[model samples]
Target: MHEVSICEALLDQLTSLAAQQGWPRLRRVWVRLGLLSGVVPDALEFAFAAMATGTPAEGAELLLENEPGHFDCAVCGELELERMDFTCPQCGGALQLLRAGRDLWLSGVEPMPS
Candidate 1:
């Protein structure tokens, strides 16, 4: 799955950051996931566990924060919180997804001395 690749990328980034900062070990990893990011939390977690094998982040916890999807209505000038459909209820206009929930960001990393 793509989540495995994503996890690999994250590990790479973490390794680079740790090397750059001269950290001893990684403690935790904070990630922000969007509702429409097309990523399953369970799958990501599984991938993390599998990919972290024999790595610095083997014992690190992956903390995920989920963000909802939102859209803007052009006709009513209203911001709509969308879960499924992206149709404006007020003006019946097509809603534009202002914030596409497809972000995979490494928010923070905690390191501890070995």
Candidate 2:
């Protein structure tokens, strides 16, 4: 799945960071995932484990923090908490996604020196 590609990308980033800092190993990785980011946590974990084999992050723990989606209504000037779709419940107006839940970010990383 796409999670595999995502995991590979994450590992690349981690490796680059570790190299930049002259770190020998990665201990943990904290990721911020949007709720509507269309990524399954379990799947991502699996992908990470699979891709990390023999890598610096082989046993690194992947911590995920979820962020909810938010929308703003143009007609009513109301900000709405959106769990799924882009419809404003308060004013029945077309909602504009202020922050669409489509972020996969590396928040922090713990590295171990050689």
Say which candidate scores most in lDDT. Answer: 2
Error of 2 at 79 (Å): 6.5
lDDT of 1 by residue, 1-114 (tens): 879888989899888898888886788999988767777789999999888877778888999877656777877774746364578877778887777577688989998766
| Model 1 CA lDDT for position 18 | 85
Candidate 2 per-residue lDDT, tens place, 11-102, comes to 99988888898877898889988766788899999999888887778889999887766677887774646366567788777887776668
lDDT of 1: 0.80
The worst-scoring run of ten residues by lDDT in candidate 2 lies at 78-87
Candidate 1 regions exceeding 4 Å error are 73-96
Which candidate number maximizes TM-score? 1
TM-score of candidate 2 against the unseen true structure: 0.74
